[model samples]
Target: MTRQMIIEPAGQAGLTAERVREVVAAHPAVAAHLGAADPGRLIVGGAAVTGRDAAGDAAGRAPFRASVFDPVANRGVELRGTVAAPERAEVAPSAWRPTPGPDELRAAAQILRADPRFPASGDVVVYQPMPPLADLERPDGTTTRRPTLGLYTPGEDVEHRIVAVDTAAGTVDWSPAGVSPAMHPGDCESHLPEPVESLRDRGGPDAVRLRVLDGGTELWNLIVVRPRASAPQNPGDGSGVELREVRHRGRLVFRQAHVPILNVQYEEDGVTFRDWQNQETRFSATGTDPVGWGWRICTRPPRTILERPDNDAGNFQGVAFHDAGGEVRIVSEIAAGWYRYVSEWRLADDGTVRPRFGFAGVRNPRTCMRHRHHVYWRFDFDVEGSDNDVIEQFDEVAPGVLKATPILRETSRRRRGTARFWQVTDAASGRGYRIVPGGHDNTADPYGIADLWFLRRRASELYDGNPDGDNRAMLDRFVDGEDIGRTNVVVWYAGHFRHDQNAPHPHQGHIVGPNLVPVR
Candidate 1:
């Protein structure tokens, strides 16, 4: 078998696993979670993020798979190693449609340059839409989505913003970071503004447009949007899902629908304890904390890396993987009292994405307790359509053969060992792709259950099994009455790791999440 593309090399100077353990060992209660996994084998926090230089420059020519660890993902990672990207489908987004060319992007930049609200530019960020367009949904049921030109800018003075221009009317809409419909920030992270470092497209022709942004110096997302002429159409009017589909000019950039929702849960004392609550991290391992949603975090400058997979073939003929993500260390009295949140996100040209969470800073000086972190990632798969279902398939081992199929599935947060992998499949077009969890089962925690949970989409199902960012008591609240049979559903994936002492210097942080593959 050909070797898989193992993400390694430092994009910028990275944190050592030993450093991570030092912080993990700070609090006894939190430290006790380590329970002897070996001194230098359990890294508490580090990340594997992608780094892309600005729009121009030879350094930015190809994309790069970056990490906080010098050689990231040398440890935790699970993916079918294939560097070959998909063949550009015969059909494409309309050439006549209003896709943003460099001219539009430059124009947008100039507009921001003169805006009173914009921060003075130092490191400027300009991007081209990968899917090359976006769809926004209206309140009326007639049309569920609208077309628009979507763009990402961190905003002036550290505030965050998303710029979406109505390609039809030439009007623009600006959204501040940390607003509702925005991803929830982690416990230690609620107090800081999310910083978006860069936005770029990978995979050439039919590339996935990825947004690499930072939060309160801690959170970020790998938002993947597939641009095509077949996307749901809109008249730029505020109504209709029933209207005919069109390759309309990019008008609306709708997210809350396409990307999944994810929550990071950390607990110790045998899953009976939790560390975050009420849209904020309740208290620090040091002591009970106070109000802090706008705390200051010193975020380091991002670095870059490059990757050229061994199996590079097809359309990736001579493309070198340029840095296409953002990697920066956000240090606040982050959590566990004094720790750093090394956040990283990588989007490859082959439709593979990784979101890694790493921690540094001071350790808990209290009890040495054992603990685990569970990232309950909620995904709303709007793959060409919002209404889709789950398909659990097994890699049935046989003599020179592998078999797969779908079945009525059940879920539990207290058990393990279910379907090895699954996908968000559209029942209508019989289309959709697989969501494969990386690393091994218990990739997140040995005691966690129902690695993958599927439920029909519901307004009430906005947060994680536990939304308040509260206790593990309400952990499975989202799974109680939800069903996943032939309906628009969200996929919740729990990826975590047990924290003990930090492993050795050369060790890597625990990276867990799914390697998203767009199924043909």
Candidate 2:
């Protein structure tokens, strides 16, 4: 039988009719309640009441006063205590439904498993060549080749080899064949075990050893593991789990090693020198230590060596020195002809050694100037994020100056797809301006080598003196009116070296130049 119900917020005594009507209209069974001819007869409150039907028909309403014995203070105010007119009652279809059973859920899962579109596990290995280098292109658009040291996977199980390619003949050559233990390529699946202690126990002591052979020398090394012990668990089933302890130890040894260049050359009674490669040399005194010094031969008069005050000087790329009593010892290796002197000494009987001193200068070669020439530009980017996505295409703004577009990405809290822009203009003339957008943020991706051709034209117009000096002036002009502290300008530089060939090393002459541009 259909029934109309009204529920409302209870007041001190009961609910008002207006609140009852608002509640009934918003109820899930609102349609049925509206169809009733005498909704007022369904009054719900803490006191009994009588009311008429919607058709103005007089009807006796069931008294619904809350019982004094009821534990709840106003039980009669609940919708359960309400009733509609007799004529409004009508049998209706059942709308209640039950939840899905276990069988149904299992069947749904099985269907999903059978679908071909379901995801499955697969492995992919990204192989990047070792010791990356850049290839240069000639004016004719022809590319010149550079030696790439090929791939060398240190911890892989499969055999590793490099195949040299000859572009002219379109052929390849392989060398230095080697193999590692079994490994599932791409999947990262191997005989390695978790809780390394357990794996070591199962694989035995020698399973994790690494062996290497060079020329006639052979070296073997082992992997070690250690585990912490856990306390005993309680007898009760509710007690937490227990853990085990383990440890590992390994060592490496070189078998039958031969010294390639062990000749020691001595000078007078105070100095001993060793030379390997015409340029690589080492020096030391009879009573001093030479544990970490570079090798160099003394080709000139013996100069007083001084110790460096700062530790940084001794730790420089290829320099090292230490104090030994009254005589200071020095050792250095310079690719180009050069000599470095280090010294340290105590003043008379003051008992204080003057802070160390170090000096480096070039020696005269057979000729005045080296004829070798290489042209290159140094580009620096003052970006905040990853080094890869920072710089954008450089557009020539003038003959030599160029500007790069800044990439910025929309953040989560802000509206999506918003673009970031860099406004560039001449601060003095207020001319030569450009606006570019679509730059990524410093977070997700970083700025790398970006082309800066836009500023070339502007740079040419501003050029009157040195290229670098003029470039700095032009940048200053663009930022004149703007507040430096408040604005964000991602600056970076890039350039290519050509003609001269040299080994890639940290302290190479070409790499030891000023790269950062002062913003002030």
Candidate 3:
């Protein structure tokens, strides 16, 4: 599912090197904060931006078009139009910004070099910063003036690195996704759709209309897809890239939702919760800069949903794109509060995406206990469109249950082999997708009952629990009586584990969510 925003000729792309420099020069510290970095990667971006769209081209590279991945190396712009003199551009020091000098850049670069966790196998990139509205702006949401840097550490293997630095606070914090080959974006990309445009031309006369959006959600951030009015290239079988369902001419359209990006759940202490403490999904903060404008930093790019890939299989490696209007900002944060949950969202070239919740700061003034921070995600899906239906699909294991029909047993406390699934299909065309649990299901625990359930969609039925502690009652109420046939539905999937007392805090964190696979 993708949402196409603005499309204009390369020449009328509105962004210029001068304007790009204005944004970068304004945040010279971020530009300088390369983090003990990739000097060569700093100069030429990463090898991935070398414009390797064809076979003869080098490996791991993408077309040098106007993409979020291309901005870090270039001068915050992905060059377009006919005249291609310099393959890329750099933000040369203009009169507008005098604070950032060679010495300052050298100092910032030291930060990366000094970190023990900084990956030696990855390329460090300082991408452009986008206005805060990049994160906060909804369909009718307000615009913002403040911006943040997006630091990317494109690693050699599956998991990469991302660190958010507050220019105003000069404070930097990162997800535990610290450099480690073993840390892969687990089951993240296995479900979502592929970056099909990579297969077909999105330009010239026969381009397909597609949009990949970095949207907001209750507990986690989202990457919503709205490739309206398009259909699978291979319609009869469902085994094909989502191509524009061609009509005659002068009209190119796709369905409203190719797929519902993500819906997350946070379950802990026998109480299931979604979003913030009071269901506050949206966030706002004022930058410390002199102007003091409000900003939504979470919306910035390198919106890479999934982590990297262990195997080089082209289809398996995920895809992600973000628009960083030319200043490099790594992480986005919220302040003036007791706890800071650095919201880091990534979208891969493949459709795999994840919204990591990095919980920091103190919850209490005293002793912390050995408890679990359980997490789950409700992947609301529409296979072909809004009128789609869903069914429960499972393997031969014969799922075990909690006072229910069938129950699937967990292999171990750590291993919950996926024997459960929910298939969402379009009733009209019979085309749909599958929503699978990311890793483990909680059936083994006596308290844990069902891992997945199918329910019709409703505006008021967003959360599994309300203000009261009796959330399970809400679930019972929604399930007691509802139409399960020929209607829209949302698949609620969960994953959890007990956070032991040894769990690192104000230091370490966890990545939790589910996956929505487009079923061919």
As for TM-score, the candidate ahead, 1 or 3, is: 1
Q: Who is ahead in TM-score, 2 or 3? A: 3
Q: Which parts of model 3 are misplaced by more than 4 Å?
A: 1-339, 342-345, 353-358, 397-420, 428-430, 440-450, 463-473, 503-509
Best by TM-score: 1
Q: Give the per-residue lDDT of model 1 (tens digit) for 161-210.
A: 34544433434455522221322121111122211112212222211222
Cα lDDT listed for each candidate? 0.32, 0.22, 0.30
Give the per-residue lDDT of model 2 (tens digit) for 94-171. 211111112222333343334363334232111212111123345976443322122223344432222222222333
Per-model TM-score, in order, reads 0.39, 0.16, 0.36
lDDT of 3 by residue, 270-330 (tens): 3232222210111222222111111222243422212222211122111122333321122
At residue 185, what lDDT does model 2 achieve? 35
How do the candidates rank by lDDT, highest first? Answer: 1, 3, 2
lDDT of 1 at 395: 59
Predicted structure 2, TM vs. truth: 0.16
Q: Rank candidates by TM-score, best first.
A: 1, 3, 2
